[model samples]
Target chain A: MRPAVRQKLKRRFAETLDLPPSVVLDQAVIHIFGDSEVKIVNHKGLVQYSTACVKTRAVQGLIEVGGSELEIAFFSAQEIKIRGRIRQVMLK
Target chain B: MTQLLWLWWQGYLTVRLRGAGIERLLNRASQVGVALFRVERLTSDVVLVRMAARDFRLLRPLLREAVNGPRISVSVLDRHGLPFVLRRFRRRSFLGVGLGLAVLAVFYLANFVWFVQVFGNQALAVEAIKTAVEDAGLRMGIPRSSLDPARIERKLLESLPDLVWVQVKNRGVRVEVHVVERDEAESGEQRAGHIYAKQDGLVTELLVLQGTAQIREGDTVRKDDLLISGMYYDHQGRRQYGAARGIVKARVWYEAVGEASLVRWEPLRTGRRRSRYLLTVGPLTVPIGRSLPRENHLVTSRTWQLYLGTAMAPVSWTRLDYEEVEWETVPVPAAEAEQNAYELAWESLLAQGVDRERVLVEKRAVENLADGNGIRVTVRVEVLEDIGRFSGQ
Candidate 1:
């Protein structure tokens, strides 16, 4: 009935069924490739974009990517591809 | 790279969005099933993003709605991919037509034979094989569709009885003909024979591979003289006769005579010249210029033909240059006349199968004619070569 109760039940079922948290808990999957690219799968939308930083709305919160020459290589309803000198990834 | 190609194939544009909340525009575009790529913030209020050409119309409403906060104006920065390329090509249709014609030319020319190659032939003359191939209708400039490799192979096998197997391959513009000649020994057609001297020579080297030596090295032999006898004694000391095989190399002398006149009539170009052009198709010739006088003229002609790669077309262009000449009596110097006579004699000696590389000695003799009008020169060359010729016993 409540949003917290619904999330807690979903996590418990995911743990019991041995399912991945990103799939069952409705969380964005962040994949970092070396230091030049970051792929946020199951993303919500774009929040902000800059050459030095990029932010995309994920299921949990805002996924912020910080680097030099940061670019949103691709932005779709399903994913956000960020490519640059990726130094840090933060959830806000 | 594949993603970039797909975007290009679908046609896309880079647009500069002049607004504060450009990310919202991208998010809205994405929510409406329109993909955006290469999003970069140029300044605080301006962002550049790439979207499919078809999705730009869908974003017009979104841009208009953003006017309430900050006027979001869109301007195309660049256009890319197939749709734009086709539009440009539509304006200049000649380029497309030229490209199409070039491709068609290549396709059409590929159907004609550009080269005829023969392979895997040993103990058979290349010219002979080429002649047989041409006789079988597989030659340069022949259409690939009309060529039946099976029929050509059959014809080659029939025309050249020595060829046991033949394969005609049509490789694009080139036709490759492969032939396997029948070996006499392998076919059990080896004959019992004696190796004899084919010409008069002094034997220098003798090797008995399957024969008894009839004459030793350094011995002189005449034409038709037997050098290796087929008769021999086997291991059991029994007399046996079979095919005799051996190499008999000898020093042979070739002689030729050349004569030159002391006084000769030489033709000199009189500085008057005429030009003529002719078109030749197969054996038919059509003159394109005025006919020339028949007598006292030296004619030099050069022929030009159309060729695509290695294939020759049937048509040819010929340019004939005629120079008027005047006959003048010139006295030949003794030394120059002798040199000319020697060159003539040497040419004849080469025609008699004299190996220039193997020549051990050369001698020249000059004799003045009795009438004092001409000089006769004789050339003799000695060379080492195999003089063995097999004769069936």
Candidate 2:
């Protein structure tokens, strides 16, 4: 979906249910703990998996995760959890 | 933790997946709803993963998805959980059946009598009672359920009319029969009888239960003398005869003399020793050597044996202890010798049936021997007790 249209639908959906847009939206919610880990929820699937880097397909675009010793702490259709010395998380 | 438990509960398989796209095996397995976990990358072209045992069959067709030949070899590593254990054990069904049959056999055998015991019966013969019990179908090796305790007791009372009271106790695998026999002669009709003195003693108390008292308190009586007369004067001044029953208590006095030598000999160990060992095999004792200890040495043996339950092994180790002892003459003081003689006199008094309890009084005397070679001690103890006996006129 287009970014503008996706934003409008999320806002409307959140307003209709009286809930937070972050919860209603299908966009990847990234949680970064300093340099230790970055957990991405609401993802599509694992596109590339390696020890040094990982590329996950988020609901919006390609989610490139760069870090040292990156391990898939957890992997499922809805969530992709990467742990270990995460240096950067880019969504392009 | 939950993953390990799930693997154990559902049964898992360890397989070696060799290919450049080995990682894809995990992805493809997960896609096929196989739930592969614990993936470890062993090499660039090989990986190991655990999947459900049931999923091993589905992975064969998916081998075509690998980059290389994708050779997969699966060996059953382990089978866990109660269901898998039962499945393996089910192959030998006789073990289960045998265990069940053994339990049932124990239950069935416990209901039958294996041993019968008799108690509290003195005058009644145990063998006669056992025969009667056999007649009642409650003997050894009989079913307890078929025997009624009350009916057996009644049968015993009928067979042996002398039983005043009878009790039957049936326990697991054992039956106990207890009976109290009646004293038919004492309670039945009897002719006249006299109460005589069983021994010489001074009468302390006397009571005639069914006859006239021939002797009163404080009277000295000899053995076989009459204490109660079965012959009594009737109301019309005529002689009559009946059984005599009474209690006669007396204070009996006794004396004993003991002598102790002033110059006596006692055996003392000289500290000289010898030792030997012997082995016993099944009641046959074999000495280790023919060497024996010197003369005048007393030999004592100590043995050690191993036992398992009630059975003892035939192998026994015995060690003999020998010590040389010599009898030496020792001069004993007169006072000590007199004390020793006094103890000997007391022992002799006890041997004559003197009552240790209720001794009214006691006296002792020590005197030098007439030849002046030894000492003599005398002891006398008095006790009050019953001394009545039954006799016929």
Candidate 3:
């Protein structure tokens, strides 16, 4: 019922089952193509959007992107594509 | 590829989203599976978003809560998708009817022959084949279905004795008539009797194939002179007539005479020219200039037209250029004119099929005209040729 207890029990169960943490823990998979495009799979939702910046929610933290003319090229329930002059990407 | 076309057919709209909670709107849109794309900030409080036009309808009810504080204004910047375009045509029902009638008319006109082309036919005139085609009811503007090509081919082959083969092909609105003409004379070249000089020349080489050589090398011969005799002498001093065959190579001279006045005319610009611009849409031509140019000037035009795929569209642009030319009299140099006359003579000599490889330049002569005003250049070309002929005895 507690947050630490649930996490410890899930880690023990994952170790016993020999399952990868990314799939078992619902971790987001991020892929970058060149310097202008970023594809984040398993994204939760869009947080903030602007021409200079975009923020999306990942499993562990929030994905913050700084760019010029940033645009959501495409998006669905599973993956989201951000395309433009992507300068920096950080998880905060 | 089909999905991309489907996206276009379903139509996409760039909606200007204006609200303080634009992020919340996007999150909610994605959560509800509306599938928004190409979202970018247009202004401080406004964001331009591209999404399916059909999906925008699902967001209308959700935006009702912010109607007073942050109202949304929707404007159709550009309309895409087939149905939206079709809806515009539906409003103008006459356009649909006119288009349908035009298509039907074009389809009807396609069944008739617009042009007829003849190919691979010699000896038998193209005019004759066209006449034969018309006789078979395959003339211009005739319906294609009324006559058969095979029947026409058969009838043409039967009517024209020279046609060895005939083919009638229907290409679009044009009909192509192909025919092969049969040879009339069989081995006519081998049967000959008299052997005469084809031109005036000095004999350079001579060979008798089946007759007596009448002229020897270095001997001058005139046109129509007997170069080879068609008669052979027997031991009893009697003459026998037969086909005379021989090869006689000779030096043939070609001469051309030309005269020109002391004064010549040269063309110069008059400095007064006119030009105009025109645009055409379909068959309608529209003038886009002050006025047409003056008369007596040459008119040339350059046109650019829009061709979509293989079909030429109605839109076109054209520019016309005009120039005024005036001829002025000038004095001519006698030596240059004489040289030009010599060049012209040489060209004419080559054009007469004179052998250029063995031209006897030493025998060439430049003759003065009797009037003492012009010059004539004669070119003597010595050629080793097969001058053979079968003279019947």
Candidate 4:
């Protein structure tokens, strides 16, 4: 399938499950398929989606993500919260 | 303006800053191969950085990155701009530094002298004493630190034999030479002796004032005669030694005759005039007027003094003088010549210290010569007076 259609389907499914509407454009969820990697860019408002794992560039403005278990790493931003078990947060 | 230039040349604006963060900043900049200098950290968040114009431009970008990443503030300063900023920051400190340098310069230029004073003598010259001081290695313009007053006194005494004693003193800037000459003892030499006539003459009169004389009135005596003797014999026939001296008045005679030409050349005054101005420098004078005057006249000169070198006095011009010449003719009469001869004879007697009452004029004659210069005159005179006397005792 097309990466954009896949991203739209994943985002709609997450919203239908009553996770949060913010999850449609605020979440960077990486799904590891068998041979290819998929990044579900939910909260960043990106028009094109990539099928391979890629690093996120610095962005301005606020994006929100809601889930019972969530984890994120912030390098140069403020007010980053992680609700799940903090697996690792390393700074270089 | 001069003061500002002096302050600039003294390296007053050169700033050196030091701190632990400065070392770290320099190391970091060096790692990046950036030519940074004069790095200083005043506080944990404040740092001062200096570099060349090109290097500062290149480091501006990296410095901005460091400011953002390290969360520290940095200021880059040029050499000229640093002094003004630092002066404002520490005004009292800079003023103190400037005053200290001025005081040091004054101390460097000050001249001083250490001297030794010699006193209690009169005949020795002050210059001789100064020469003795110079020989002892103490002289003008020598610093006070190098001179030892006690050592100078010892050396001066060793060098000068005429000085009775010397004392060293360190006056402010001038070495005064006070000297005294050694006094010598008097010798016992006799001052009174026998007086004797220098020539033989007749005793015309008696003008005795002191002591008894052997000769009576109108007695003739020869030279070396004992006119008055202080040798007295006692009743036991022993001669007593004493001072023998006396004055004797005697008659003496001589003759003098003189002849002089009536016509003589004397400088005559001519009513003529000329004036000139001169420019003088030191010993050299250049006349600034015309070389020749309208008439051939005598030139009388006077000198006027100009400026003394570097002294504040008015210029003076004194004219230096001399004269030029010609000859003219004048005539004389025989009566005039005889009168002139009598006048000359009287003047000659007065010049010779002869009493006017003791001279008797007898004859006068005048003769005209063949030359244009006038007549010659001859005069005869006779005088009798007591002319023999003794002068020494």
Candidate 5:
């Protein structure tokens, strides 16, 4: 099947089974704690990292976090935790 | 936090990477399960990361590949955790040996009795109980493994006839010896004895528990006079001898004399005071200042001695305070003199063991001196008390 059709089918299946979209679609689960920290589960990899901004590749697109003194606290195959003054979280 | 602790327990290293493709390096490292943590970018091309020490060796080849392929520089900043700590101590091995020896010394010393304590002993002497315990092979510094508390208790009960029950408790480094003494009345057994008068008194009450009553109530008896006899006749008229036990309450008299001068001389402070110091080493006394005769002065001396640990040294320093006094004669009224004499006489009576609660009657006599300079007083008190003394035959 095509990628678009597969994603549509996974979304419908998640709604029918009462399951989370992230679990069904293999999507990145973003968790923001106030404006200081962000945790991304099922992350792909780090694309670009700097003090003011951190950009990571997700399943469908790229996740960019803009803030001051942004740091990649830790990263594994499963998740990535970013901490600092996270002013904006943009999905591209 | 648990992950951080786990990483620390497994040992870890902080590596600083100076390169342009640090992000790719981190992504590749995480993909291979290297667990890159605390990835902070210092500059555009400089980043610091932390990874487990075990993963560090695996990362070495990857680092060499990165250095050769992408020209990345990897330098370890710090090494932490138990493995590195042990590696550092491998040089100063004597310190570990000393610590082990110290622990061994403590363990060895703990196996010996350091303190021997006696409890629940009122009538029995503590030193006598300790002596008994020492004789029973349980004393200070004795090995705990060699101690037999039951045997010690048995030996203590055997050696001290006064004790009815004994218990020896070995508690860690302390040995506790508890003893219960036999009551005097309860211990009156088959030993033949006679109950005698402890003092001269008129017997007012008598109750005999054993033996035969030799003295009746209201009978006057002297000290050492037999009040009860161990010799008695049974119901079959056969003669028997046993311990004599009885309570003999009596009315005893105590007399005391006191004298007071009518013209009393009082010492008045003359306001002249002097102080001198003296150092005494055993029997030798050395004066620290000018020594003056202590005549006609009230002297108050305080002594301080040097002590080494719990033992006192022979060296001592004394500070003597002397206040000069002058004697002045004051005329005392007869009534005041008689009152003073009475108080003094009563003090002497009380000192002779005359119980105030048991006192039935008191008598005092006052007489003027032959030269009319002083008065003499005599006081007498009678009290009801037990005056029985048992003499074993």
Candidate 6:
């Protein structure tokens, strides 16, 4: 990605996440697994982690996980952190 | 940029770190008797501490502890404030202040005259002399160091001829002036043109000089008789008068008997030196010196000084005088006692103007008797001498 586009997306993501924009995500390093745990590390230390075993889906304005409940207010972000049993995974 | 970097390095890092090091150094310094306190940060790395120099020296070794790496440095700044700095060099000793005051007091007292007096005559006006003295720079409140008393006295005598002698004495702050007035002559030079016999007797001898004789030898002349006339005729035989003065001596007779106590008291002089200063003010005199060195003694005479009309200084020189007291005793040889009485009678007659050539001892007798005080002696003497004389008539 271009540096400018990356900076704009980082700002928009920080605004959507309600975190300070001054927070540097550039030093952040991400780890992903197809059906395993997810982890993120920044220059300072570990920032986030998740373990999953659940069915996931993303619709136009909502996301559902294993049809346990449909909570529209909980649907947010391109990258989601999950911590539960994963039945399936879907990306819109 | 390099300069700015150097400044930031030196000013900010080195200086500030050195200041911070001062407190730790002082803390280590005060392990002895000194104490450092009230440290405050002046810069990011700079700190100032107040402590005594002894403590600072004691902590000198710990100052190096603050120099850890090349980036850090240490330095020490004296904590004496502005007021202490201003007063540090201006202290004076108490002795110096006291000496200065004493000198000033002496100088002031030296200029003030403490006493003034005028001496010698009572007729001379004291106030007038005082005024003259003041005009001559010898007044009160004038320093003795600057006054010349002799010159003042000379000037005073120059203007007042009535003063025969003048003297001025200065002792410390007191001044004394002595004056003596001139004496007038006696008035008795107006007897002339007459001559009279001094006594009533027959003249035994006569001697004439520059006068007319009215009586000659063997002439029976009464008292007040004109023995010589001063009036004489000139070349024209006219009467001319002059002073009548002559001396006549004639034989006279007298007898005296006196009794003397064999024992008599006489004063003996003892040589001793005693010094005293006499102060005189006008007619008044006061003795400022010692009265007597010996307590149980008699004073025969004393001398004093006058200033103005009063005595301000008194100096007395006293000597021991012994007085012989007479006492009664048993009678001794009458011959010696009679001789002593004769000598005493001769002395007495001589003092009474008995002519030495004609004086004669007729009878010598002494009766020794006991008296309350001493032995007594009685004697008689006969004296024959010419006792007639004539003065100006």
* Top candidate when judged by lDDT against the true structure: 1
| Native contacts present in each candidate (fraction) | 0.93, 0.00, 0.78, 0.00, 0.96, 0.00
Instruction: Name the candidate, 1 or 3, with the larger TM-score value.
Output: 3
Prediction RMSDs, each to the true structure: 18.2, 18.5, 10.5, 34.8, 18.7, 40.5
DockQ of each: 0.54, 0.08, 0.49, 0.01, 0.59, 0.00
For all predictions in the order shown, the interface RMSD in Å is 1.1, 3.2, 1.3, 19.0, 0.9, 26.4
Give per-residue CA lDDT, model 5, range B313-357, as digits (tens): 445799999889988999999999998888888788888888889
- The runs of at least 3 residues in candidate 5 whose Cα sits more than 4 Å from the true structure, single-residue gaps closed, are A30-39, A47-55, A60-74, A81-92, B1-9, B19-21, B37-47, B64-71, B103-110, B115-132, B159-166, B169-393
* Candidate 4 off by > 4 Å: A1-92, B1-190, B198-202, B207-247, B264-272, B275-316, B320-325, B357-388, B391-393
Better of 1 and 4 by TM-score: 1
The local lDDT score (0 to 100) that residue A67 gets in candidate 2 is 78
Candidates' TM-scores?
0.58, 0.41, 0.59, 0.31, 0.48, 0.31
Model 2, span B1-393: residue lDDT tens: 786687678777666666554445555655676655544445555555666778778877677555365565444555455557567669878887887886566556666776678888888788988888788667776776787999989888888887888889865666788888887445443757888888889998998877899999999999889898888877898888987778999988889998999988776899977788898644468887545554567789899964434333435689988788887889999889988899889789889888778689999888899998899999888888788877754
Per residue, candidate 2 scores C-alpha lDDT tens digits across A1-92 of: 99789789888989998996667776788888888777787766666666667787776789888977776655544655677778889998
Instruction: Give me the runs in candidate 2 sitting further than 4 Å from their true place.
Output: A1-92, B1-89, B93-95, B183-192, B197-200, B212-216, B219-226, B253-359, B362-381, B389-393
Question: Which has the higher lDDT value, candidate number 3 or candidate number 6?
Answer: 3
TM-score top scorer: 3
Score candidate 3 by lDDT: 0.74
**Share of the reference A-B contacts seen in candidate 2:** 0.00
lDDT of 1 at B307: 60
Q: Could you tell me the lDDT of residue A42 within candidate 3?
A: 91
Q: Give the candidate order by descending DockQ.
A: 5, 1, 3, 2, 4, 6
Candidate 6: misplaced stretches above 4 Å? Answer: A1-92, B1-202, B219-226, B245-247, B262-313, B317-332, B355-393
Q: Write the per-residue lDDT of candidate 3 for residues A5-40, one digit (tens) a residue.
A: 876777778888998766766778888888899999
Write candidate 4's Cα lDDT for B65-183 as tens digits: 56534443344334444345466548678776787775564344233452345555577666777777888878865776786777777877778766656777654443444444443
Global lDDT of each model? 0.86, 0.75, 0.74, 0.47, 0.85, 0.49
